[model samples]
Target: MTNHKVDTPSKIEWTELYNQLLDKVDVGIHVIDEHGKTILYNQKMMEIESMESDDVLDKDLLEVFKFHNNQHSTLVQSLQTGKTTKSKKQTYFNNKGQEITTVNDTFPLLQGDRIVGAVEIAKDVTQLEKVIKENVLRKQNTKFTFNRIIGQSEMFKSVIEEAKRATRTSSSVMIIGETGTGKELFAQSIHNGSSRSTKPFLTQNCAAIPDSLMEGLLFGTKKGAFTGAVDRPGLFEQADGGTLLLDEINSLDPALQTKLLRVIQEKSIRRVGDTKDKQVDVRIIATINEDPLDAIAANRLRKDLYYRLSVVSLLIPPLRDRKEDLSLLANSFIDKYNAMFQMNVKGLSEDAMQMLYQHDWPGNVRELEHTIEGTMNLLIEEELITAQSLPTKFRRRYQNSQSSIPEIDYPSLSQDEEIKPLRDKMTEVERMYIQQTLEANDHNISQTAKILGISRQSLQYRLKKYHL
Candidate 1:
């Protein structure tokens, strides 16, 4: 009879298991009793608040936790009404007194029909909020759109329309342009207009990193894989579920280019020194100053990689090629610098605009930006940036409407006046100049030599032989 009744734990065991699972979870968790007294707090919650379980338990919620004013009222209301409320709240402050933002979920805990307590779960959202704020600021600060591309030419308009249409698809895109032609801005606009607008759009400059480090940086590395590696994920991993922009993709070394090709084809990457592969769902957008096809031909880039990257290729014209855009771009930069440096400079004069148009802008848009900034710094009272304020090189190169030399006029020689032989005419002129110099110096050979930029002995010999 005693051996017949060894029973297993029932619903109580399941409830206890659930509580254990919540306690071991990574998110902060807490429970408050009907009297608004905190009854239980998991380890994560205690660590986040930097307090002990005993210090928080049996204390009133408002007194136990440091919640912002608005969050405190909302949480109290949710508990009193036995309703569930989810919102972002600032609840904890670090030791340095910096507030930590958290996404919190508060739900009423019921004992049958009566509400016994409330459970709150919070996730740290500080980084996410910071990113959102930064994106908002970037959008507000820049006039980056299809219309703001600074070109009215038909070719430029066609390119913008093509880029906008490409953004609708999830296919890979390659943007080719020279330096300072706003390739990065074009990439940003495409990502912003894409269907994945809400997701992250990250960029990596391929030319900025060394070859050996680039592999690890793009694909990430495991802890202790290298000198300072601490199990970090790379840009490709970070950009998973969104778009990854590879700026200066042509600068990537051949080895890394091959790996990138694999990533693009396979949609998976194994971190350096890691055996397991990670699946990444991302849209790839690559930009380069040089032609990827040329790079492939030169063996600097993998052919397969180039083909994979250029599934849809878009070319951004250099500013010089888009002469019509010069005025628009210049005014945009002037407006920006005017607001930035707090200057009263109005705009460029007609002559100045003409000078800018005529000059071959070797540095493209970036050069124009610097030139405008320099003019603003030097300009004090002049509201308009005139041709006079432009740098000497810019003015000199573009000044002449036609040939810079003036027209010449000559008088006809008389037939009666025997035109001296060409050589005899030059000899007479030379003799007269030497005699005049010697007389001016009182016949001092050294002084005359110095004046004529010749040796004293040579001057004395010439004077004696010529009988001057």
Candidate 2:
């Protein structure tokens, strides 16, 4: 028998090793007790925060550090929920009053069922945020004229012509399209070609912000409006001489929609909690994912507001609607990433092009762009992206769609439904598609679910419902 002797360190050595290890890491590490008192912030954290070791350790974090104290704060959320909070972007001021952004992951330090403390691992992304802001500024500055739209389809051409004519006059333009059909791109192009091309161009997605903040964002807030509020310029004021694109415009609250209509008609805005109004010259361009008439019918948008905003309407066709442009758009995206990633990827292979056309493209142009960029990022050696080089979701969808042709008829779950109603025939087709998808992947539920874009539980329900 052979005996192995382990060289275990003493308690003091173990503690020293832990501190040295944490201090050597790149990311900032902060720890606090369950009561939100600081306990074990590392040296990296002190350096990032511009503080010394003794300045933070064993103090109540809220009292010592300048956190917003809102739900967006990392420590507050993790301590309240008693769960790991991760990848939440927090914009907070440093000791020098410089607003720094960080992507943080915080986990509760647990001992059995009793909660002891929590630890936060943070990465400073302030520079990355600066780059993103700069890119946005560049887009606002660049001229995305009609020539930059990258499509030659007749339907697409007609829309571009209408947009060009609309740019001749500053009638409020409303662009309607499915999500990811380049509504914002169209908005920017219209702004660039307009008489106000030299002025500032800004955008606000109505659906992304809360109603409480939406009002203040559209119309600037006064110093006395709320706690910590300052007299700042709003989107209307900022884009005074140029254009302000309100994306997902229908998502604004009904009351706010009425206010928006007033601003469009009055060409002025009153800051929140202010008694006076400020006049401004700004072109309002709104975009909706669904039809404006449908939104009005559903009462999601004000009827009067709709009429006021839709003076000049443009509809960007979906990728599936302009299937011919798929190849062109694919090439355009390839060119974009080749410059951005410095890759020599020539273009998609013939089979890959066919696969792109076969897709339904529920996510439209944005999804296609992501698919192409994602594939190019992973692609090595081969200059031409083939069907095999496609993302897992795209490849699976293409394969399942190809297998659905009647020429390769597999066993149908509803065999007797062929002579029945159209709905039953559609169900039979659905069943066959799902069954074949399952079989092709050797009955792996998770992969099949991903291919179909459904939860595993949803797939299981369908499998049982269809008896596949």
Candidate 3:
């Protein structure tokens, strides 16, 4: 028979190893006696409470340390129960007067089935809680991505690539796209991906604020600079060492544009009433719906500022130009609204999808999203959205176009055609013609309006009025 033996370490060596293991553990451990006096505590526990082991040992638990109502009650309940209470209780104040939140489990120490003391195990959970909160906020705030940009066409791919490339640089990027093309999204992506990601990313709509308030809003005002003037830092200062997006920058007043130019050029700003110049390290990302060159020529944008901002200009293609991405975007919005409204509406029907593809989205992605949301709100059943489920204007637009071909006019056709007044007939013809033109132009309203010898705004008004 073969003999096998296992060797064990000495008692002293084992004790040292156990102590070393407990010392390296991340959780805090402490023990209190039946008299409410601390008998043992680990280094982690002392560090967590910001107290030394020597100072805490033999100290009355309630007298030496104050706990919040929740923590105190939890500990007392555990002691009374003579059993462990595992919970996520928070102790508010630390030694430094800062709030410290922790998750703790308190267990009663048993000596022959009699509670002699209690041991508490805790972990610092402040950072973990903060991370969880931030994640929830991020999920709630932004969910759309390139897929949500809508458009499967090659034009969209080119624009996305340009946007991706612009995100890699600190150079001022100017996104030139018609209103509602999701320019803000591209700007957000750039800021989120840049080296200044951890810093503040601010957005100011140049058109949203009036000229009178523009200076104060962008460069900030000093105390008593104006009525009810409290000292407040402007967006430029607030976004210091970060990125500031100026949306619809062309809408700024000419003088404000000049001041903005200097801020962008010199990398500094002088507050409204302050003489001292404060240095700012801010990256400017401006968006404009108009052509920068045209804006400069019209004195709407300063030439120098326009040139500086256009150092890396990106043009976001209109949704109509990227028809291929329509299905992807439509489905994305369907899923989003489905979850948001808690509705069971699944998706668009093939005919509804065809109608979507055929329609010219003058308002771009924003318009599409709104349309989908509106449809979902009006949906009556769980079935797919059909042409009949579409808005009245869309139905009229589609029906008028379908009937305008002037085919063989039978009684049924005659009833469908019902010769109305000349003005009404002309209006119907005009509407159908416009729809056909927009469809032919792939929903490019600018080109369609030009071809129809009408203003783009006029076309937009008609589309909205007809719910097209």
Candidate 4:
């Protein structure tokens, strides 16, 4: 026993493992020394900032990225003050003039009682900004009315009635449901049913938006507020005398929620970079994809703001919870699409309807609608949708649930089919595993990556390679 030798990893080996672990995380990780020089930059951070290790390693933060001032940089501010900056949204330009926005949480690394360096965790929202901008530009007036809402279930009808009652008053309304459960549809119907239906109806999704930009987007912006800034009306102003739908209100920054609470209390708004408070009579109808209590417990939503916005809260049941309406909804969607495509397609076959009922419908009604639409695309001479005609994604799920054997782990090869090379067979197996894992996680890239035991970057590469 005394002569037995134990093998342990060396310091260098441990360091290499630590670095690899950092690169696997979905968010960007950056570390800087007290002198503001980059010490450790992970792979995700490099991808997010569009720079390589050669451009950032051992370089000053100011030299690598363009910030208005030292104070504007979260890592720098944390280093100088030895204070933490949590979930602060920052927008800055890289050396290539490409604007990057990230939600950052920075902490000062300390040695005993002295600050030594700082580490930052950032989540990029640059693409989200572009999507929000495009959506805003393409926004049209509300077209959904209560009459257009299709649901015959008693529970569904009760919620519809509650929403109808909400339209009679100007009080704030909160619609709660899971994603794709038709929260926005209910929101639009409420706006159209209200007395202020003739007025402008505006919608803004608060999720994944930077706070700085969100502030100006919600409140008006004053002239010369920032570079190229002009006087512009925000959602509150645009939706004046009408309803403003704030989708996923919990996603809004806590500070912005405080401002919103004040607005609801005073019925007024103060533009960004302006001192004057202007009155607005916009009715607020907010939506949340989770339980409000959970959002408050997690500190994602402010409690006081929830009370102000939920004067008339309506909860929409998930599709699985109210399966009585499944056939009604499916037939409606089929008729709508058939009219749009100018095709006469009959209703779903018994097996097809059984497949629909077998699913828990994690995506709810919207998922069912999309399933029908996708199945329709595969139809040519077939007038009715059979179980065999469903999209591969849905069909595979049904098959896997019914099969005793795990078809997922081993791809089926027909005896008469041509044999493929080992490389091609392995590639096909890898692609299938990635696709199934992605579907299991509801197409969430980060979660899918984690489930697949790979980095988000690697998962994205596979998605592009397989066109999944």
What TM-score goes with each of the models? 0.56, 0.61, 0.57, 0.60
lDDT of each: 0.75, 0.80, 0.75, 0.83
For candidate 3, which ten residues in a row score worst on lDDT?
135-144
Error of 2 at 117 (Å): 26
List the candidates ranked by lDDT, beginning with the highest. Answer: 4, 2, 1, 3
Task: Provide the RMSD of all predictions against the true structure, rounded to 1 decimal.
Answer: 20.4, 17.2, 22.0, 18.8
lDDT for each residue of candidate 2 in 339-415, tens digit (9 for 90 to 100): 99988898988888888988878799999999998999898778999989998877877866765666756566576
Q: Write the per-residue lDDT of candidate 4 for residues 411-441, one digit (tens) a residue.
A: 5888999898987876899889988988898
Could you tell me how far off, in angstroms, the CA of residue 168 lies in candidate 2 after the best superposition? 0.8
RMSD of 4: 18.8
Candidate topping lDDT: 4
Q: In candidate 4, what residue range of length 10 has the lowest lDDT sum?
A: 453-462
In candidate 2, position 76 carries an lDDT of: 56
Model 2: number of backbone collisions = 0
1-468: candidate 1 lDDT, tens digit per residue: 466777877999988887788789778887888888887788877665666788778888676556554455345556799888665365555434556666577888888989888888875545434544554455344435566667776446767888899888889998887788888778777877888676767776788665766787778877555423446677678777778888888788987888898998899998998999999988999987865655777887777877888888777766766688888888999999999998888899988998898876768899999999988888888899998898887777776763455687966888888888966776677679999998999987768978986544345435653679
Root mean square deviation (Cα) for candidate 3: 22.0
RMSD of 1: 20.4
